[model samples]
Target: MALKPSQPLRLFAEHLREQRINLTERWMKAVFNDADLTESDRLTYEQLADHVPAILEELCSALEDQDLDQVEPSIERNAKLHGRLRWKQGYRIDELVRELDLLRQVLLGAIFGYAEQYPAFTRRHEERARYFIDEAISFVTLTSIREVMTERDRKIDEYTGRLERANHELLLKQKLVGELYESRMQLTRSVVHDLRNFLNVFSMALQMIARAPARTDTALALANRQVGDMKTLVDELVEYSIVLGDTNAFATEAIDLRALFDELVAACVPTVEAKGLRLVQRFDRELGTVVSNRLKLKQIALNLLSNAAKYTKVGEVEFDMHVCGESQWCLRVSDTGVGIGAADQERVFKEFERANHEDVPGVGLGLAIVRELCRTLHGDLRFASHEGEGTTFEIIFPLRLDTDG
Candidate 1:
């Protein structure tokens, strides 16, 4: 059932109709002056006043007829459009509510002003106008907020879907990397295994030829040395492959630094003396035990010592160990070898890279392996060298290795 308005209510509605343009102008002025409605400032007059005139017409019709049902459809449509436009203009929900409340206040103030101007419009007409304005603004505020929330939810879903797809792609790439690494390890093992079998046959043939009557000792010796160099290369390839594939390879235990140095020096002495170079050692007797990967430390030390002995012609190769800090230690290998040139120093640690020494027998996995092993053991390797003088390689290791690291 539709409720009818009194004659004064109809007159008030007609008065509002006459002042619709003025009312809209007043509302626009309020929005522009409001600090909280700053988003309206970015809009042109048409954009800021979007659907407001239509909303005012609906409000007047509902006031005249006193039938909210008749005006609801148009009010809802206009209010939804206003909400979406304000959202597009970067209005916050609070700002939207504040702007609409201002509209309600403007209409009520106009009603009170009209009642004061005319003797026929009493307090009853003013109260009726207030009731209708409250009803319409409530509906508009609800509908507008629902639209803004719907748009916000839709955007949230869109961003969530993008994040999910990105995570899936990252997982796929990680799986591909794992598969490629395994394939490489398999290939390296197969190739190294076959090469070792062939090398064994060549080594046996060289031994047999050395025993023959027509054997040239110099040529046989050279052949034997070449065979030995090939074996060393194969061994380095295996070690490099293992280090690359296994991150959990550093199985740690407590090691006596003095004992480890003594053993390493003893092993390196035979090779250093064979090259007619003196082997020198300096150890800190007070050097106590350290918790680290003994095998990796041994490999790094041996590689540096061997390189020192292999390059030095007349001068000594020094192996030194000392306490570098309160909880750190340094193992330094220095030699009067043909030192690396400044240009080649940067490329020295790269795989299969040798520093300006083509005639030197090396497949160049030595420093590369050393670097990887140093990192695995939580150590830092640094070197200083001059062209004619020598190279000194120092590795600083923590006194106590952290297993988790």
Candidate 2:
């Protein structure tokens, strides 16, 4: 007997069941082509499409029989499975929903493909086919939402517990911290105050040794240089401790920019030579000193030079000083080194941050200290660098030294 003509919805639904394999294949291909969905390490076809065939049979059966009881339970089970699996795979709900939409498109394209084979599929047939697919979407998404909400509630509960514990511990510790902070402040001030007096003694002893008749040329020069460097370090420690407690701690004095630059260059030479790198110092003779904390200025200059020498391996490190306006001067340190990447440049000034992966050592505190010291002096610090090219740092500030040139 010849086949009887039927409604288009029933016919298309039957066609979908018959072409379920083709539909699944097309859906998988569509998913693989999607860059967002093709992360197989996280979401493989086996995980995403395991229930596709059953999904098609049940959904098409619903369209054919007009009964949802047969399909709803299966779709709900599969939807819950997908929700848990995708969450484990690190998929956000938005990405999962996106792929589901793509699956719908691919399946609809399969329906259009069937239209060419069966003349009974009109646009009305497309609408009916969509109604069945739409029902499937609603069921799957409802179950998915339920599962996700369940997971979210569990996470919220766990995090709430952790937060409650942390708050309790913090409350207990704050009292002890309050007591220790005062004691620490007192001890630090006492220690640093005593240390400053020793630096003054060290200065006197170096001068005495430099004038002693028994002192050899080489030994006297070495002792004087070592004492100067040690004084710089000691003064730095004392001022740093004082500044940490009070930003207005360091005393300002009459300093000559020319003579200070010469002394700093001499102090930094041994460190540069140890690294087997050339250190060039250029200064404008007219850039007379300004009234500033001489020790703090020396610390900033030496810190920059040390960083330049630390990062640059083969190429020369240069320090340039010049008078900008009548009362402004610039100190620039440039290095031919492995320059900072763009991602790290902004954060390099943050405390304890390294700009590159190179084996360059240090706790990443230098730039942060440079920035803090610059703020103390009301100076402008800026940098320009390319990844492979060199980096240049310029510290520009008003003159604060004696007018005696």
Candidate 3:
């Protein structure tokens, strides 16, 4: 066989092919630290750093051609993707430009450092390599700027549309101020009324505790219950604001659902037994590991189970789980307690409204919180209730196979 030309170009290309993955990882770590980039609430590393592999491969291909012209496709794709992500994450144009400048420097440094080890490489080869990367970086910068501007224009268009819609609504409602003012006043009065009711409960419970001696324990327990109610009111207020303000504040991880359920059941058993009720767990299928925000899931489960235990005075409270479908799982809690009436079904979901308006110590925020949480999990929160019979709350969390993403 005839001997093929074993030039520096072949050596460089081989290095890229062999070291592409390891090099990409190193590049990402460097970029992550060097740029002070916060990884959360932004595009993941896979999304953010997707273009690096293609760029490396293209550079290897370019070595054979003795030019950088063939690298345009990868560069353009990279620029657009990066620009889109930066725009989403609120990165300034200058910051993105600086990052690209640093990336180009780092990549060139690695390539040049490798070249320096080869005694056969000449200054002319070094200059050619520098020129090639410099041109490529310039192209990347231009494409990035163009894509960012495009995204900016898109956001502006969306804002304009929203404003126009608001203006249209205003024009329609201009003559309806009397109705709007009356509604606002009613809402204000309702809020004030609810606040006063809660305050009255607290104040009366404290008075009873102070006056009674023979019934001291009972009065103290009532007072403590009122304190818990006040704390729940405050917690619900905070949680409602947080859940409404930014649903993306938390992250999810893979966890064994069965393990979590076991913990919950064990914790709830004491309370259920104390209430003279039986706690029953029914597993329809094996609960494999699932991807979810553990704290939030715990909150959801705790609320449901606690509510079930709290309400069920006579019969057993049951917790059920099963694989509902190919990608969905269902968790349900049922209590044979004082159930919800049809009249209050819609009212209960409203802020500060309770199903057991007369006897329940809660501010009616649990179901509301559960509903908001279920929405975040890409799941549903629903219940079936018959007054004086029983109630069941089912929450379904769909499987996300792409955990660690």
Clashes in each model (backbone N, CA, C under 3 Å)? 0, 6, 0
Candidate 1 matches the true fold with a TM-score of: 0.55
Residue 354, model 1, lDDT: 78
For residues 69-188, write the lDDT of model 3, one tens digit per residue.
666787788778867877777877886776677667766776777777875555666666666667777787788888999999999999999999999999779857877677457546
Whole-structure CA lDDT of model 2:
0.74
Best by TM-score: 1
TM-score of each: 0.55, 0.41, 0.50
| Segments in model 3 whose C-alpha atoms lie over 4 Å from true places | 1-225, 401-405
lDDT tens digits, residue span 1-405, model 2: 433333666777777788888788788777777787645345556776766677777888787776678778888887887777666666767766776777788777777787888776777667767777877876776677678767778888999999999999998799779866864675466446545654665666566676875755555566565566556545555555554556445677878878888898898889888988998889887877587778878878888898888888887899989987877888899999878889989888754467865476554556766888788877889998878777899988878643232
Candidate 3 residue 351 C-alpha distance from true site, Å: 1.3
* Candidate 1 ranges beyond 4 A from true positions: 1-222
lDDT of candidate 1 over 1-405, digit per residue (tens): 433438778878888889998998899999999988878888888887888889989988998789899989999999899888777788999999998999999998998798789867777778888999999999999999988988888888999999999999999999989977875675566557646755776666677676774665655665677578778777888889898888654578999988899899889999999989998889987788999989889999999999998778879999999998898999999999999999989978866677877677777788988998898888989999888899999999999999786
Query: Which 10 consecutive positions of candidate 1 have the poorest summed lDDT?
Result: 1-10
Model 3 — which ten-residue stretch has the worst lDDT?
1-10
